[model samples]
Target: MAHPLIDELTDSSFDELISTAEVPVLVDFWAEWCGPCKAIAPILEEIADEHNGQLKIAKVDVDSNQKLALRHQVMSIPTLILFQGGEATKRLVGAKSKRDLLADLAEVISN
Candidate 1:
């Protein structure tokens, strides 16, 4: 299974998506030119699909949408932010294995 990828998010939409989402949301901050971001994309997709109704997975292109990235203080590519109830709960920087990601997500979700 693969999760749907969202490439762009506006202030209003991003707010609504993260704040109002019924399930936990995983926001992947990435750019097209970033090799590391490209590497971890598939793992994210798989997690999104596998978690399906349990979670909402989205992607933001740092290059195209600067506000969200700036607001989040994203200084690097492949930053994964876990949001619950519209608030950022956890952050993972750099490319990570699927197992590690799942563990992190599980820790947050379980709590």
Candidate 2:
């Protein structure tokens, strides 16, 4: 992982991660073949750093975790879902600028 604060989530670990999370969990559903997914990686990393203890950032490889992706209804790559209290409170589809991404997330997660 490029960011030390980011967690790589798999099908098995998905539930436990979200359910037991102490703070909001931002899950990124992406695939290696997705150009937009690659484009958003660094922005996510920067967010992870800026938000440090306020929230947690996680990534699920859609290619490797198809079941998890389907469970979350990830229809597009670079889908960012923010989970609060084990429920998805916000979702953003496609790659966006760091400011825009943070603005979307700030709606559900308190900066």
Candidate 3:
């Protein structure tokens, strides 16, 4: 199951959420059939819990929101994009360890 804090983003809600967020928004671009995406979900949930106020977590299902996936140039599953100041600051593709995920966010969240 998805964490309560993680927002399920669609085409309409995607731009609004990312644009208006006060903190860095980490968006997970995934598809239902993607194994790597599923593998990284728990790590994302933990990050969401650990960094609740410092960062915002959102997920976009590539299948449901094809336009968003295309717009973001998500060529692979489990694509994680960190959006700061309404622009994509970091992009991580494929599954990542919790340590790596946290390390990637540390700089962004601290700023």
What digit string (tens of lDDT, one per residue) describes model 1 on residues 1-111?
323444356655788788788888889999889998989888877776666778778888888789989999999989999898889999999898888888888854441
Best by lDDT: 3
List the candidate 2 regions with Cα displacement exceeding 4 Å: 108-111
Candidate 3 regions with alpha-carbon error over 4 angstroms: none
Each model's TM-score? 0.88, 0.94, 0.94
What overall lDDT goes with each candidate model? 0.81, 0.89, 0.90
Candidate 2 global Cα RMSD: 1.4
Candidate 2, residues 53-93, lDDT tens digits: the string is 78899999999999999998999989999999999988889
The window of 10 residues in a row where model 1 has the poorest summed lDDT is 1-10
For residue 65, what is the lDDT in candidate 1?
Answer: 85
| lDDT comparison, 1 vs 2, better candidate | 2
Q: Which of the predicted structures, 1 or 2, would earn the higher TM-score when compared with the native?
A: 2
lDDT of 1 at 79: 94
Ranking by TM-score: 3, 2, 1
Model 3 poorest ten-residue lDDT run: 102-111
Best by TM-score: 3
RMSD of each: 2.8, 1.4, 1.6
